[model samples]
Target: MKITLPGSKETLPVGKILCIGRNYAKHAAEMQSDVPGEPMVFLKPSTAIVRSGGVVVLPKQSKDVHHEVELVAVIGKGGRNIPEDEALHHVSAYAAGLDMTARDIQSKAKANRHPWSVAKGFDTFAPLGPLTPADQVGDPQQMEVSVTVNEETRQNGRTADMIFSVAYLVHYTSTIFTLEPGDLIYTGTPDGVGPVEDGDVAEARVSGCAPLRVRMSRELD
Candidate 1:
């Protein structure tokens, strides 16, 4: 999938979606999960991206689906083993993002110790807003990130609650996978993650970035 940045129509080819799990203590507690000593990483292919204001067509295979609001960092430069101090230099832009999941499927996968590809990597599962240039967004750690379902606030928290900072995530992820332009890092979600049903409107907002709005639809059997 190709995504366009703010003030520029030129599309950037999406390479991959790197997601961090349980990065917030409250969220971890809500999920009954332990906070990891280091970042818990997962990958979602480009096909999972749903453009801003698009529809999130729910997969028929699962009954419980969830929305995770996050701050997304878009990579501008590629590098490996990057220093934390230099990590932000690799960022081109930031955006509000939603990490959608088939909760039932994810739970089953966890029980079997299987990969999360089937549960978290479905089409229309990753929704993102317009990208705001890095220079425009200062101190990402202080930004407010939130999600609303049907106009009722659900997830609300500041980036300050992140267990692992954005720069650290970039540096850590680059060490395992070669960071590349257009690669997106979802910096994890806060507490209050819950189910989304058909016709529900999910909106995600990151301070200083365009709000990402999506309508949920169930695939007709």
Candidate 2:
């Protein structure tokens, strides 16, 4: 099974995963949901990832597929109930990532009050960076995160829009899940979420961080 890639040599640091939902007010409302009073958390099995410059295999179950641009943080150490100022200390690295979603399936599951695992967690659903060490990413709070599909900017946002600061989520999440050295957390996405068709190019960038360019294609029949 030979695969083609631009940055195949890049090795990503692994860790327990945390996903923040409804962190961005515009995104929350676009999905017809309210801004969470607190952080909305979710997870993507690490197995779902396809590193940067890799292909995003569009699933056949796709009624509608969409891309969510997010800021991903890698944890260096495990800590519980950490202080906001202290949150920076736990970060090992950062990367710009895409939380690709099967929107129609997700909506159906939500309507039935079912779990999002099947809808959100699938092979090759999470496409990530070209990692940048924490030292390389300064002021994680003020970076620009943007996503474009087929050369058009679909979603553009800033980390400043996050309802729960990184420190808050790090502290808030540790209390629930025992974070490990290899765990990663996807901070959350902003407004302008939409569909990704096969042959689409999904390019993402984090200001002052590296750029990620991925060309998406449908999975083999």
Candidate 3:
């Protein structure tokens, strides 16, 4: 799928979306999990993306769907085994995004020791905003990221609280998979995650980037 780069006529094709989990200590604690020594990574397919102002069709199989607002790094340059110091140079843009989750399903999967792919890979599971050029987003770690549902704030935290920095995540992930242009890195969420229902409007924001707004609806029979 393709996403339009704001203020420009060009559209960037989306590749794999790599996501970090438990990157925030409080978030990890709130979920009753331990902080990992390293980043816990996962992948979400491109089909899961819903752009700003789009509708998120909550999956019928899930009773508890939660929102996780995140700072997304859009890769501009491709590389393999990139060094941490040079990682930021490969980023083309940044955006505010939501890593929507089927929490009930995820919990079950975790209990069964199964992969979370099905719980996190449904359509409309990922909502993203227009890309803001990296240069315009000054220190990624300093940005404040938040999420609100139906006008009430659900998540509020700063990227500085991340256990794994963006540069480190990039360098580490590249060591496992070849980083390609259009690939996205969803630097995990913070505390205060909760559920959303039909007709709920959720907004995600990252400092210096366009806010991503989306409405939720249950799948029609």
Model 1 scores a TM of: 0.97
Which window of 10 residues has the lowest lDDT sum in candidate 2? Answer: 1-10
Give a tens-digit lDDT track for model 1, residues 81-178: 99999999999899999999899999999999999889999899999888899989999899999999999999999999999999999999999999
Clash number for every model?
Answer: 0, 5, 0
Off by over 4 Å in 1: 5-9
lDDT on C-alpha atoms for all candidate structures: 0.93, 0.81, 0.93
Runs with alpha carbons beyond 4 Å of true place in candidate 2: 1-13
lDDT value, candidate 1, whole model? 0.93
Q: Model 3: runs farther than 4 Å from truth?
A: 4-10
TM-score of 3: 0.97
* TM-score for each predicted model, relative to the true structure: 0.97, 0.91, 0.97
Sort by lDDT, top down from the best:
3, 1, 2
* Candidate 3 C-alpha error for residue 106, in Å: 0.4
The TM-score between candidate 2 and the true structure equals: 0.91
Clashes of 3: 0
| Model 3 per-residue lDDT tens digits across residues 45-139 | 99999999999999889989999999999988899999999999988899999999999999999999999999999998989898899999989
